[model samples]
Target: MHVPDGFLDAPTSVATGVVAAAGVGIALRRARAELDDRTAPMAGLVAAFVFAGQMINFPVGAGTSGHLLGGALAAVLVGPWTGALCISVVLLVQSLFMADGGLTALGTNITLMGLVGVVVGYAVFRLVLVVLPRKLGSVPVAAALGALVSVPAAATVFTLLFAIGGTADVSVGKVLAAMVGWHVVIGIGEAVVTGLVVSAVIASRPDLVHGARGLARRTALRTGEVAA
Candidate 1:
């Protein structure tokens, strides 16, 4: 979720800003290894797609609407490091141009959605892939599950941050419960969107999907051996 200004104090925002900056710096360096001619173009497309996806928010409950976080989707389509950078770019543009997320709380949004979301989501996807069959079909399933888990995880992290530096006098437990509760429903939407997109990409251009590369390489090798 794009956190607005005044939700958190200046100190908390500054701390998150520092963390976001460092995370972006690391991502920029690591993304070079992940990006190539073929996938580099896909990165731009993925960013645009995510930005657009975030614009349409569906009502979850209690006047709280949720949108596609796009962390798992990006990480599954591109590499995790690049995915972090992609989401950061989207958030930056949204904050500056659209004024969707607060400028002062931009770092908090980046840390929550960009850093935590991508890192945790990608990790979950990889873990699921390890347990599941290493086939093209498994990629979408893993991506869906990853997307499902990531939303609540991010929400939990945000709740914790709010407890530490929330400007309003709110019950931490109630906030956590409400945040996680609504986000679970939102995760379903996230899962559906991520699964559809990942499945479509795997169907057409499996090479562009970072999470499916190992399976692709293995399939290629098997095909070559059979030909031989």
Candidate 2:
């Protein structure tokens, strides 16, 4: 969800701005390590894909809408640092030109969707991959689960920030409930889309999928043993 202006106090907005700036700075340096000639072009593609996906929002409760955050999808297709940068670029463009998100709340949107979303989503993806079968197919499963968790996680963080510096007199409990509740439904769509995309990439070129870098598909050998 793209937070609008005046939803939070100036101090809260400024604080999130600092946090977003720091995240972007770190991402800029670290993303270089994750990119190379073979993989660098994918970053631009991922950013564009996320931008388009986010434009199609589904109605949520309270007259708000939710769409694909693309954090997990990006982190799976590219690296996390690069993924964050991708999301930040999309948010910047949307805020300035599209008027899809608030200019003043850009930092908050970046912090929520770029930093928190990618960090948590990628972490969960890695964790899921560790537990699931070590195969290319598992990458999509991991991505789906990661996408599922990332949405509500971001929503919860936003609720906390709103609780501290909300300009409106809305109840924290109501906001939290609505945010988490509706986002849970949104997360399912995120999971499905993420899984489908990851699966497609894995099918054609698993090497291109960042999360499938070390993963390999297993086949049954003549002896009925699985081999990678």
- Best lDDT among the predictions, by candidate number: 1
Pairs of residues clashing in candidate 2 = none
Residues 100-147, candidate 1: write the lDDT tens digits. 899999999999999988988899999999999868899999999999
> Per-residue alpha-carbon lDDT of model 2 for 1-228, expressed as tens digits?
899899999999999999999999999999998899868998899999999998788775678677899999999899999999999999999999998778889999999999999999999999999999977778999999999999999999999999999999999999999889999989998998899988987776666788886554232122124222
Query: Stretches of candidate 2 above 4 Å error?
Result: 59-65, 216-228
Could you say which candidate leads in TM-score? 1
Candidate 1: residue 12 Cα off by (Å): 0.1
Reference-based lDDT, each prediction: 0.92, 0.90
User: What TM-score do all the candidates reach, one by one?
Assistant: 0.94, 0.92
Error of 2 at 27 (Å): 0.5
Where is model 1 more than 4 Å wrong at Cα? 218-228
